[model samples]
Every structure is written in C-alpha cells, then in structure tokens.
Target: MSGSKKTYDTDTVVFGAGTAVIAAAIAAAKEGQETYLIEINNQIGGVMAASPGMMLGAGYPMKTSIGGFFKDYVQRMYNHTPPLARRRLSTLENLGEEVVYDPDYAIFL
Candidate 1:
C-alpha cells in the first residue's frame, strides 16, 4: 500500500500542532533549528480549536505569569486590535490567574 518514503531534512520534527507542540516548534525554530510540525488535523491548534470556552491557566498556583513563549502569546492576545483575551481570577479557590479568550479570535491569532 505504501510507495516511496519521504524524508525531511529538519533539526527538529515535532508531532502534533497543539498549543505546547506549537510552542516547542517555535522555540526550536527560534534557536536557528530547522523545525517541522506535523499535525493530524487540518487546523494548527489541537484541543484549543476543538474545545470552546477553553481557559488557559498561565499563572496558576504560583500567581505569576510564566514567561517565554506563553507570555508572548498572552501579550499578543492582549495587544490584538479587539483584545482577544482577558485575565480572570480562577473560579476555584487558590487557583490563581487564568486567561479567557474568544475561541474564534484565538484560532485566528
């Protein structure tokens, strides 16, 4: 059933295009590595695209923003023309900060 095997010359090959996977790909690319991302779905985001009203708990129990790619992503959402996201206190006690964003806008971003 299979024919020729295609090979990719990449320093990093990340399977899946989930939030974490995307971040890893981006980080690898940023480090001057030739990174490739493979996703089963047509879209980039995995659970993020599937689940509506999904909240990203960036600054959870520690109550501090986790810097790096996540921080940049949050900043981008905040800086969007229409402001795609907003910080909120988690409903659960001591859960710390969470980001609630428009799923459509999130996908676009």
Candidate 2:
C-alpha cells in the first residue's frame, strides 16, 4: 500500500462486510463520516454461511432480542429459499420450522 496515494479526502475506510464490519460501517456512515466497506472475498455473508443456522444470537443489537440487519438478512434468505422436503434436514431447519424443501433452495440460496 502506498501512503502517498490517498483514496479520499474524508476520514474513514472500513474493512470487510462481516457482522462486526457491517455494524461499524453502518455506525460510521450514520454518523455522517465518510465510510467505505471493502470486502476481501466475492461473498459478503461471512461466518453466517459456515454456520448454516442464522441466529440473531445473544448480545445482538435490537429492541427485541434479535439483531437488526442480521435478522432482516436471514429472513430474506428464508423468503427466497423453498421450504425443505420431509420437514427434516441434515441439520435443523434453517427457518426453525417444518416446511417443504425448495429443490434449488441452497444452490441458489
């Protein structure tokens, strides 16, 4: 990296789109500061993909116990994917409910 070539006149550049990274990006951007998110990989979902189960988890940011953007993101995932078949999965239902399988679900999901 060359210190000589400055990217922007404003002050902050966020790295990655991980949960923590997105939080920081949203916070910084909300504050009116110049913020940028740089993702290393083509994929942006981070650790969520590996875990399979999308949980708001403990200590997430939300008025209710669930987190904000994270919850919305997961819901969008379920909304798009078809319900699983047999009402059972190799793992627990990602949606945490019994539903038919969407054949192309995970592939496109």
Local distance difference test values of all predictions, in order = 0.77, 0.51
Residue 103, model 2: lDDT of: 31
Per-candidate total of colliding backbone pairs: 0, 5
Q: Residue 43, candidate 1: how far off, in angstroms?
A: 2.4
Candidate achieving the largest lDDT: 1
Please provide, for model 2 over 1-109, each residue's C-alpha lDDT reduced to its tens digit, 9 standing for 90 to 100: 7568655666678887666687687778878988878888876645643444433333334313344654444455556534323323324333333323333343233
Pick out the ten consecutive residues of candidate 2 with the lowest summed lDDT.
84-93
As a whole number from 0 to 100, the lDDT of residue 44 in candidate 1 is 78
State the lDDT of candidate 1 residue by residue for 1-109, as single tens digits. 6998988777999999988899999999999999988898778777776664434554355667558987898789889988888887777766566777876678677
True-structure lDDT of candidate 2: 0.51
lDDT at residue 86 of model 1 (Cα atoms): 83
Whole-structure CA lDDT of model 1: 0.77
Which RMSD values do the candidates have, in order?
A: 2.3, 6.6
